[model samples]
Target: MATADTMLQTALREPARRLTLDLRAVTFFDSAAIHAVVRVAERFPGTLAVLPSRQVRRVLEISGLASQDWFDPS
Candidate 1:
């Protein structure tokens, strides 16, 4: 969670219009991590794209976050 927040903070400091998070290697993540990602996406709006792992996908689905507009699977 802390690590994800730190990474997101650093990434947001950059001047990119879009942020693509390739979370395919992340096999495990808790709600805190999900919260961090969702916060970032909320801050950036349509600029967030998430390529989530199967586990992450399940978590998002279970958390009802997968239906969010910012949860781009592609």
Candidate 2:
């Protein structure tokens, strides 16, 4: 999970005013990814959004990270 951790670290350090995760082409959304999204939201607060792919939507939804409470899809 080194790659996942690195990706998460990179995202956490982003200086954007808003953070949008476009997972529309992602085939795999694991716990690490889920944690990353949560971390981003915690860091950016209302500036977090997500566009998850159909392939990984179920995983994200089931994980309780694909919701307006977690992020707004924009």
Candidate 3:
């Protein structure tokens, strides 16, 4: 997940408007991963779209980061 985070950090440098999280390949994710994503979102004024599978979505929903606030509609 840290590797994904690093790539995300770098991706944020571009002119993209949203961050799509493909959590299909992710076998597991911890609080640290959630925190890292939140921190990264804070770095940007826009939003972050966490496009996790049903399984991963459950984790994010339980972790309290499962709102549109994290998803960029713009």
Clashing pairs in 2: none
Q: What is the C-alpha lDDT profile of model 1 across 1-74, one tens digit per residue? A: 65787867876787788888888888788977887887788778988888888898899999999997767666
- Which one wins on TM-score? 1
The window of 10 residues in a row where model 1 has the poorest summed lDDT is 2-11
Task: Count backbone overlaps in model 3.
Answer: 1
Sort every candidate by TM-score, greatest first.
Answer: 1, 2, 3
Give the Cα lDDT of each candidate: 0.82, 0.71, 0.64
Each model's TM-score?
0.86, 0.78, 0.62
| lDDT (C-alpha) at residue 21 in model 3 | 58
Residue-by-residue lDDT tens digits, candidate 3, 22-42: 666667777766766677677
Q: Candidate 3's error at 4, in angstroms?
A: 5.9
Ranking by lDDT: 1, 2, 3
- On TM-score, who's better, 2 or 3? 2
